[model samples]
Target: MANMDISLKEMMAIDGAIGAAVVDYNSGMSLGVLGGSKDLDLQIAGAGNTEVVKAKLRTMDSLGLKDAIEDILITLSGQYHIIRPITGRGGKGLFLYLALDRGRANLAMARHHLRAIEDKLEI
Candidate 1:
């Protein structure tokens, strides 16, 4: 199993990865962060995406969808944001946030890599 720092480092190795963070959605706090560019503030990004996760979860509850979320992808003109909620034992309240440069990132491969990272995450 990968420790938090090692997991974040592995995420940064993904092609075109701009930044990555492990966050607690319940508190909107980043537990760990890495690789942010000047334009990206990983702390703020982590908080903002916490709202995204909460909103989707709330919607699912209201709609009575019993399924859990695998990931949420937000695509923009210049970037792509992926939010993956951690589902390991004791992982229910946290998530992995990844930002990628659209021009350089391979969405399919990035998704695959994120899954691998998630699988190995110890916490």
Candidate 2:
């Protein structure tokens, strides 16, 4: 099983990865962060993404959609942001956040790598 530190590193190893963090969606706080560039603030990104997660979850509930979220992707002109909520295996309210440079990133492969990282993450 991958520990938090190892998991973040594995995420960074992904092609085009710009930054990664383990966050508590409940508190909108980053538990750990790595690799953010000068233009990005991982702490703020973590907090802001918490709202994105919460809003989607709230919308799902209101719409009576019973399925759980696998991940949320936010694609921008220059970047891709992936938010994966952690559930099961004793992971309740945590999430893995990954940012990638659009020009260098292979979206499918990045998603696949992130999923693999998520699967091995040990709380």
Cα lDDT tens digits for candidate 1, 44-81: 99999999999999999999999999999999999999
Question: Would you estimate the TM-scores of all the predictions?
Answer: 0.98, 0.98
Assess candidate 2 and give its TM-score to the true structure: 0.98
C-alpha-based local distance difference test score of model 2: 0.94
The Cα local distance difference test for each model comes to 0.96, 0.94
Q: Give the Cα error of residue 51 in candidate 2, in Å.
A: 0.1
Q: Model 2 Cα RMSD, Å?
A: 0.7
RMSD of each: 0.6, 0.7
User: In order, how many clashes per candidate?
Assistant: 0, 0
Please give, for residues 2-102, the per-residue lDDT of candidate 2 as tens digits.
89999999999999999999999999999999999889899999999999999999999999999999999999999999999987596788899999999
What lDDT is reached at residue 48 by model 2? Answer: 98
Single out the weakest 10-residue window by summed lDDT for candidate 2: 86-95
